[model samples]
Target: MGGTDCGAYRAGLGVYAIGRLAGAEAAELFAHLRGCPPCRAELAELRRVAELLAHCVPAREGAGRGPRTGASRTGLSGACAYGSRGPGRSR
Candidate 1:
């Protein structure tokens, strides 16, 4: 599926990662990833991003108190820049 192009490979990265790619296409991409440094780096980056996204849980606040737990977005950084500005802030 046109994986020779960096953009095209990136477009299919999420699909491949989530196990939604068709068998033939998945196999092809797997082969491509092995010898492609850029693709391998991107796949690693996507995995990192996916793991970060999975931790996105809504916080529960109590009356006149702090959050119920330590679950937070602090220190998270990416294209969204979730927590890279400053302390207790995001940009």
Candidate 2:
């Protein structure tokens, strides 16, 4: 696995690509990217993934047809019929 330094640099690169960095910090991350090949590659992959997810179709309501429990019906049980934790508060 990559070390923490690599992880941090990768994250910084990701943030920089998404325009989340400020003036001096953005310049710093770009400078780091110039010297760090691994971080540059990881940031490219992250950007691709972000682009793909951005275009994904959203699931329709009532599309899921599992057994209807009280929690599932009212969405109060915080468990989607598809086995995902429902929205609202986290457990």
Q: Which candidate is the best by lDDT?
A: 1
**Over the stretch 1-91, how does candidate 1's per-residue lDDT look in tens digits?**
2346666567888877656788887887888887789888888888788777658745456643644334324533353443446455754
> Which TM-score value belongs to model 2?
0.50
Score residue 33 of candidate 1 by CA lDDT: 88
Residue ranges of candidate 1 with Cα displaced over 4 Å: 1-3, 57-91
> Please, what are the lDDT tens digits per residue for candidate 2 over residues 1-68?
23336655565666776677788878877777777777778888888877786589576677547745
Highest TM-score against the true fold, candidate: 1
Candidate 1 local lDDT, residue 39: 85
Candidate-wise lDDT, in order: 0.68, 0.67
TM-score of each candidate structure, all chains considered together:
0.51, 0.50
